[model samples]
Target: MSKLEIHQIPVLNDNYLYLIKDPDSDAVAIVDPAVAEPVQEKLDELGWRLTHILNTHHHFDHTGANLELKEKTGCIIVGSKADADRIPGIDIQLEDGDIFEFGTQKARIFEVSGHTLGHIAYWFEGSDALFCGDTLFALGCGRLFEGTPAQMWHSLSKFLTLPDRTKVYCAHEYTEANARFALSVEPQNAALQQRFEDILALRAKGQPTVPSTLGEEKNTNPFLRPDSPDLQETLGMGGADLIDIFAETRARKDSF
Candidate 1:
């Protein structure tokens, strides 16, 4: 199978839009577009036709360009079956675990609904790539906008099943701020401390620190490291339930 070529397009204040391609078939798709002109410009620059719009959720920032892009390129909009009513110009409704195929390229769908009840992530197994919208971030998870902490925790657990090398293509550039909050949660985590410095350097150069490896996040992201004894101790919730550690960390992050 040909590798999936992904182009990261930073938009708005912190949102990221991805333009992906299946080289074998020259099929191209965009993930969670916030605006249309940038996508159109990128498509024109690459000379690749936009064939599909893969929306991870129904949030306005993620789906704002769906209708316009679909109308402009005649691209089919693919979204979660659970949010079919909310996604504008949706052409294909996918349930959790369904495979979205574009020629030889295929992605396994994961319903990771913490940010939104119907949010779905696309995992391209062949490419070892995960395009998780807001459910997961580089160093933080999305706020509990439409679901409970238990629900978000369950959604995050699904991601743990993927290989450690999986590249996390989350939907925003919130890593720096997340790193700061993570340090506040686990100030003594050596890996997190180093990661925090690394994040600072990256942002200093005006660089993007996205597409973080799942291993890196698991090691440093406070949300994913709720099981860490250090984090539990830091929160003074030693010997606590993992979910409690998670909830407390998330709650603190809300205030941090």
Candidate 2:
């Protein structure tokens, strides 16, 4: 296998569209192309042809460019099998545990339903990258739009099984705001405090705080720390079930 290169393209509001390429083969795939023009521009700039479009869900912001990009680049659209009907121009339907290969890169799909029931994340183990669309964020998790709190908990738990060094490539740049909410829930956490300051500086400079490692998120992300004594105490849910604690934390974030 050859080394893969991933480029982050900022799109609508805070969304990020990734351009992944296998340098050896010159094969490229676009992840969640929110729009067609910018993606096409990127492909033109790189002088690479788009071979595939990997969509994480059916959200308009994520798949809005599916048809146009496919028509323009003749790329095969790939998405969750569960969302085939909702995903525009889907040519390849993937399910949990499916292995999708392009050039020298292989990605394992994980059906992490929470933000949406059909939301799936692509983990390119060879590249140490996880393209998690909305299921997990920098410091927070996606809103419970279609799944239950328990289901979201289960979905997020799956990420814990990955290597701590895995780089998380989430779909949005919501770290700054998420940091604020995290601090509210774990005010006494020194790790969370330092992370908030770091996020503040990064956002101030118009820098991206994405591609955070799983290790960093496990230590600082409140959504992934349901067992933290400090967070449990802050929520006044000490000794409560982890799922309930997680549910309470999510609810607070929703209203935060």
> Candidate 2's residue-wise lDDT over 92-210, tens digit each?
99999999887878889999998899899999998899999999999989999999999999999999999999999999999998999998999998888998888889889999999
Give the per-residue lDDT digits (tens) of candidate 1, residues 158-191: 9888999999999999999999999988998999
lDDT of 1 at 222: 88
Clashing residue pairs in all predictions, respectively, total 0, 0
Supply the TM-score for candidate 2.
Answer: 0.98
Per-model TM-score on C-alpha atoms: 0.98, 0.98
Deviation in Å, model 1, residue 196 alpha carbon: 0.9
**Could you tell me which 10 consecutive residues in candidate 2 have the lowest summed lDDT?**
1-10
